[model samples]
Target: MADTKTLAEIEQRIAILRDNLRELVEQAAGFSGAANEELTADRINEQQAELDELLKKRDAMTKS
Candidate 1:
């Protein structure tokens, strides 16, 4: 049988993925030109919030 992961484990993986996405977003920022001046903290925060919600859901699943 395949190895099983508890809910906590899943949440940790989701958090790691979020961090990777954040790093990618930061790297992409350097390439943003005048055409894309709308990149702001709010956008990144929104992404973070989305990731947080996903992690929360993963955590909740483990409670079942």
Candidate 2:
């Protein structure tokens, strides 16, 4: 019950992060300047790292 709920929440967060990553990529493509590009790239890396961690957690939970 609780585990299921938590898993659902995590899944929801993962989906949102994926969407954010997509938008970030698009924004990076449209934007110019080294500073702006670096900022966007940093954000993308953060989101991707978070997404990867969440995926690993979800996988472990499912396996359990």
Candidate 3:
């Protein structure tokens, strides 16, 4: 139902998604004491799921 995303839009989305994913990775790696032991396996799964879904959406947009 939505129109296709422009190349710039797709790229911007990818960059944003990548940044979010990088932050998650940093948290998972225990970058700060506040994040240490706070990101459990379940939390990681949820974060990864969100990223995965976004990637799928991005892929579909590019395919179209």
Candidate 4:
């Protein structure tokens, strides 16, 4: 069983990831440079994957 502290930390991490992902998406949309755009797109994908994992972790913690 996860303790309340651990659960809280997971929730906090989720929130931060969500915020970061949102910013990355917004930045990617406006990015114009070809090379920079590609880099930004890659970053967006990476952040999205991290967000998904954190969400799954949070769900599992709550369910247990």
My TM-score estimates for the predictions, one after another, are 0.46, 0.96, 0.47, 0.85
Candidate 3, residue 47: the lDDT equals: 58
Candidate 2: misplaced stretches above 4 Å? none
Give per-residue CA lDDT, model 4, range 1-64, as digits (tens). Answer: 7688988988888888889888988888888999989998888889889879878888888888
* Cα lDDT computed for each candidate against the true fold: 0.65, 0.96, 0.65, 0.86
Model 4 TM-score relative to the real fold: 0.85
- Per-residue lDDT of model 1, residues 18-43, tens digit only: 88677757766775665443554456
Candidate 2: tens digits of C-alpha lDDT, residues 1-64? 2399889999999999999999999999999999999999999999999999999999989888
**How many clashes show up in model 2?**
0
lDDT of 1: 0.65
For residues 1-64, what per-residue lDDT tens digits would candidate 3 score against the true structure? 3355565575676677677767767766765565454654456567567667767776776677
Model 3: residue 41 alpha-carbon error in angstroms: 2.0
Judged by lDDT relative to the true structure, which candidate is superior, 2 or 3? 2
Candidate 1: the clashing residue pairs are none
Return the clash pairs for model 4, or none: none
